[model samples]
Target: MTRRTVRIAMNGVTGRMGYRQHLVRSILAIREQGGLDLGDGEVVWPEPVLVGRRAHALEELAERHGLTEWSTDLDAVLADDSVEIYFDAQVTSARVEAIKKAIAAGKHVYTEKPTATDVEGALDLARLARDAGIKHGVVQDKIFLPGLRKLKRLIDGGFFGEILSVRGEFGYWVFEGDWQAAQRPSWNYRAEDGGGIVVDMFPHWEYVLHELFGQVTSVTAHVRTHVPQRWDEQGKPYEATADDAAYGIFELAGGAVAQINSSWTVRVNRDELVEFQVDGTHGSAVAGLRNCRVQHRSSTPKPVWNPDLPVTESFRDQWQEIPDNQEFDNGFKAQWELFLRHVVQGAPYTWDLLAGARGVQLAELGLKSSAEGRRFDIPELTL
Candidate 1:
């Protein structure tokens, strides 16, 4: 009996998500968990070689992780036969070229979302991976979230007899890299860098909607640039070339409607960083990052709108909390484990390049809708 160890070359290993999500949380941490029990002792441990742009930064990160293999040359790493997988966490603008190079080098790939900034580019990469006969996957971590997973179970169990609509509210005030260091990368504020709330996040909603409810058939969107300028890491001003907020209406395949409001300018008002409310004919469920609550018609409360009346008690007690049944790890980390299993043990992983293309398609359609001031029909992604 032999154990298979997958050697991974991590591109953009020093970036925010690259460091936190892929490296520390996913590969190193999961490896510590003895490679995410895939049954039958067919464990997978990542023999990772960190690839970055700066030798100093790469070496520092390697030392932090007690790893010695770090490189500044991506092409050199790809040319190495021992690198069976090329994982990308590069900026969205850089992902396409890196993934293409990895595919050309005959290595399996796992990459961060938007796979490419545009639908055609994403489709091309998907086709390239298919033509090359290499395994490829994208990160769709939100679907694997524990709270969302439970909500999915409820939906699957008919708790929502017929889902009428889904409302998603996701946002937080991203720091203006000037006065307060921006929580997100500077590129996220630049259009050329593939940064924009709509482009970056709609794919997440698209997949979640498709996976939990149904496929999106059409989209009507309104995008806005709330703050025209934001500061970079050095407290220098940079004109924001991308939109900060987007509101979209999606018509799903089953006639279910979904509304998504994604922004970088809103303040958090709830327990979860991201919250969703699914309303059905029989009941309604509200799910956040930390908790889920349900309200049935039988237990529903009536409400009246009044300007002078106290509003605290109307809907406060209408829903009951769903008990937390499982410990939820970081969403990115969980997806990483799954990808490893999918690669090593052939586990059912549907977040492939095609799925990524679907997300890009929706984003493309959203952009079209926003630009033309008309609803756009989304054609299905043909693998």
Candidate 2:
């Protein structure tokens, strides 16, 4: 068989995540390191053509990455016979339309999450890709985190036997753009652009829950917009029409329960942006972004809470640090490498469009549950 190098046409390359996460961290750094090692006869490296709206910005990015090809026209890139794959890191609202066009143009697609703003649109895109006989995938990077991977290993090894409940606390204080310049895009605060915590993050939790415990059978959630207004990059204050925080209770398929608190207002007092505490009949595990601690039934604590007395110690003394056994890689880079292997070597990539659609389905359910003030059952995707 001839060795094939995948040529990628990257749309939204000038955006925040496009430039920082996908382009710089995943593509350029991986290319500089001589491509990703598939651990066999196969290897994959992306040869990307930057596509964006601004010529100067595109040209500068191309020069910085040593890429000779840059185009202001997305249609022209899609028309090029040399480009076999189209990658999209555009905003959530624009992703579906661009992906549809790419599929229509006979190009494989790898796009960012929340593949579409709603379940119908996401499912439609998946169906289109299947009909077109094109490979399609969405970015599910949370499962690749070292901490989460370690948690998965423990669960697989029965460290958490007969898991009862799981708790996830995720947050960071997003700058108001006026004072410190927002770390995320301004569009993320606008509902018109499909910007909201529920849509943006439920996909991540869906996969994480599926990977660690079991699939979510139902969800009851309450979402709120903590800050009513926020400034954009230009210091223009805009009405925040999206939810900045969401509190959700998930019922797992196996009778286990899980709670997730996702927010943009909390200050990080811990070691990472996200952390999980899983409790089981036999043991429990606490996992952060880079480390994990386990406490068996033998070491389980018995304590009583009292505001007048000293705080009771939980499993602090029994906390064992998880050692680093592999090289550190960004979550996005790991997912990108896996996608490349899936394309080049026929490796199994579970983060398909169906999985992405499932995420949107959950988010939609969450919204409905919040609106109705009741728990909602998640419907299975027919596709």
Q: In terms of TM-score, which candidate is strongest?
A: 1
Candidate 2 collision pairs: none
Score residue 309 of candidate 2 by CA lDDT: 86
Alpha-carbon runs more than 4 Å astray in model 2: 1-3, 38-42, 312-315
In model 1, what is the error at residue 47, expressed in angstroms?
1.4
- Tell me the tens digit of each residue's lDDT in model 2 across 127-197: 99999998878988888888988898898888877999999999999988887889888889999999999
- Which residue pairs show collisions in model 1? none
Error of 1 at 374 (Å): 0.7
lDDT, residue 65, candidate 2? 69
lDDT over C-alpha atoms for residue 2 of model 1: 44
For residues 70-189, what per-residue lDDT tens digits would candidate 1 score against the true structure?
Answer: 898999999999899999988888889989999999999999898988899999999999999988899898887777988987988899898999999999999877777889988898
